[model samples]
Target: MTEQNENGDFFLKYRNETLFNDKNSIVQCLKYFDKDNDQSLDLNEFEQLLKSLFSHNGNSYQIEMAKIKAMFDFFDSNKDGKIQLIELENFWFKIIKPTLFPKNALLIVDVQNDFITGTLSLTNCPSKHNGAEIVPIINNLIDTVPFETIAYSIDWHPADHSSFIENVNNRKLAENSPIKENIKTFDSVIYEAYPNVLQILWPAHCIQGTNGAKLHADLKQVDAKTDSLGRSVIYVYKGCLSDIDSYSAFFDNCRLNETSLHNDLKKLGITDLYICGIAADVCVAYTSMDALGLNYRVIYIQDGVRGVDSDNIKKQEINLVNNGALLIKSKDVYDMVGCKDRRPELAYATFLSLARSNKV
Candidate 1:
């Protein structure tokens, strides 16, 4: 069982603490994970060690296998594919203790079935956005990356919501002669709630409790039950207000009202956010912008996101990088995270473009 201090804070017990704080523990753990009993650990061996360490004593933190592999690469400074015993010892004291012990959150935006394969499927979307392709990537991340908090931003809308083209078409059909005037999908309509606000009507999707609103089968679900450390996955429903559309996880499009996400993160003491999900040009872009505005250092996982419009997405990427969001490939997450300076290395042209762009 885990141990607790006098103040009721949970921590590693004396025996466990000594094991982690010393080099012998590293050597022992390495041997246990090393299936061949070799002094060096391969990718599979390294991954098993990570899973064991994090899940030890019912800690219940989910970590991605890829990040574990990345961690291994960082330790294998000799550029060898396998991690030597001495390399494992160096990692425990120099990297792992300082970098990953802090509080962090992983924010996944709109990985629902609707965005993947439902009416609003990005596969054949206007920009031919293949949103479904991100599922396996994200699932892998969920399985391997360890974070204090896991939050999901779901686009839940009522059937009569103003953003639906069907509702707009129905209203228009009633007021106009069908033969003379017909409203089609993707029609733009102005709602009186926010006058002059252009509401790009989408196919009705993610209605409250519908199957379309559910998360994709491949995505891992955090248990509703909190672990011993008081950690569990959080679900934040946005775009529920009938009149307005909410793209950012923190607030509506107009910023009229905010979601519980900001307060929740604040309470959790989350200083950094790792963001990934579907529709990069829209939801992911907006969420990254808001996170930067909120003073939270944002890291955009490039491989873990898909775009609805390729052109728009390229522009959005430039804009996000300019606005202080660090762009990184998913593989770089483990190594890059070990440093206090999180600025990503960029080419001259990329930096210049980012410096000039103001909007996503």
Candidate 2:
């Protein structure tokens, strides 16, 4: 078999020989890679270890010799030419374990009643897709996928939120605003108060404590404090400030203010994010983009999202893919999470992260 086709076999062999073997500890594994039996890993032995860890799913992974040397030097503390058992253990726990078994999270964004069947219903938008159609699809993922963390983002807007069309008169319109009179919903206007704050106006919806702000009744809500499965549940409330609008769960549109989502996921050591929810071109797209920016492996569930505009959604999908976001189906998530159906794209993403960290 070619080197590419041998990747799966190599991984299985490595798992059986090193990871699953009860007799082989971290020190033993390091010694096994020490071809000369010198009790420590030399530069050549170290390169072999990194190659095996990086190559997965029939991908012919490659790295410059200079980078491999840098990695070896990094692990070889005290300016030692060889990697000892102590150094190998640190590398195994910090890098190898995370690469092999990543912590995954399912991020459900803005699946509220208002976007589904109320004032800001997507059915009335250009695409006219039923926003409620995604609820069952997302619920199935929640029930089946064994994700380490589940996060639900809510658009918790105040009654006088600036994005509301009715509240247009509340803020002074910027001089650059195109339409000043007879302001309508879906109109993009720049507000003078925030200094060039361009916002898309929508009907009054998702006000705090209102039925519109609540998640759809059919949607499954996991309690963060008491999850039966011991999974971490997080609720991220965005657009809470009346003056600024937050499309991404992590940060506001201007990126001036941040929510608790990034730190929450970081606290749990989440490495991958499977994002799906309403308005694919808006909230879902923004969240996915931000997740990518935050160095999270983003897998977007294609069928589990509904958008306001078909053209905009297509454009956003292309943009996401160009920026390293993986577009996947809901069905593929189970295997991907379980590591049964490994993807080269995700593997490459992980490699890129390690390479960029300058530690390897």
Candidate 3:
């Protein structure tokens, strides 16, 4: 590395000056901040990391940008265009630790197969582990809501899904983790399996035949029986868009999306929605909030949903309550809509208490 100082003295030296007071921390921090495929950082990228650590009041994306920028300035001492791998070990890694640890926030973003099983996720999703308890609650909720229809966000990939390992052509064309790889996100990936430059995407995980790709077995039986599903029940599937990440049944994240649920609910004269699903902190929480925002009376069954982390659960629960979506345990609902003759396992009087509560 060579550079001309402010005094116009030209000197060439190594970047190992402050890489470490301790060697282990240097190696770890360098590995953490280096996200892009390239080994070097630019000024903009270096600031992104720095801003995140110091600036406590910003969104995740904002913090990410700042962190990226900070890396750029710290390593590119000579004003060079690119940073070498060794330069990262010298100066940048030292200050990067306090920057990388995430600040805790309370919000439910989604609970899905991709998240529950680490097959296709980078977050510490809490709901996946609690699947055992959450599933039965969902089953009970489904049974109780006899008149209402259900909308599902299933990732029904084509036989040759662009995201699958089976599609060798896609694997070759796409980078390991392309920014817009899925057909749902970028419509171009669907028809032409082989693209010019697919981004570096996660390794092939959720392709069709893979066990990690299938929906929960319980949801599958119900999904399979959709045609046989009660006439009163309606099902809408989202996330079928090859390039998009469809979290909500109503719309894909990237596109202006809509579903029949709203119109169908209006048809049935139902203004209230009992929203519950996997990963209470994520998709289930997001959908309920959107429902309340849309002026639908939203009721999120607490016992019926699960989150990936304690922090996610705490955040999502608060969001649900603030949005005017009533949060209740599963037993609470079973008691409310439950028939007088057909009682839940609980005592009859307990049922009345929930049924008569404000949630209804």
TM-score of each: 0.63, 0.78, 0.45
RMSD of each: 13.7, 5.0, 24.2
Q: Identify the superior model by lDDT, candidate 1 or candidate 3.
A: 1
Q: In candidate 1, which residue pairs clash?
A: 63-143, 63-144, 63-145, 64-144, 64-145, 122-129
How would you encode candidate 2's per-residue C-alpha lDDT over 122-229 as one tens digit per residue?
Answer: 999999989889999999998888899999999999999999999999998889988888888999898887766689999998999999999999999977677666
Question: Evaluated with lDDT, which candidate comes out highest?
Answer: 2
Candidate 3 similarity to native, TM-score? 0.45
Writing each residue's lDDT as its tens digit, candidate 3 over 195-310 gives: 44242223344444456555565652344246353524545555455554445555555435665555655675554466666556655765776665555556577766655566
Tell me how far the alpha carbon of residue 109 in candidate 1 is from the true structure, in angstroms, after superposition.
0.3
Candidate 1 segments exceeding 4 Å error:
1-102, 169-183, 224-231, 338-341, 344-360
Clashes of each: 6, 0, 63
* lDDT of candidates 1 onward, in order: 0.69, 0.82, 0.45
Residue-level error in angstroms, candidate 3, position 260: 3.8
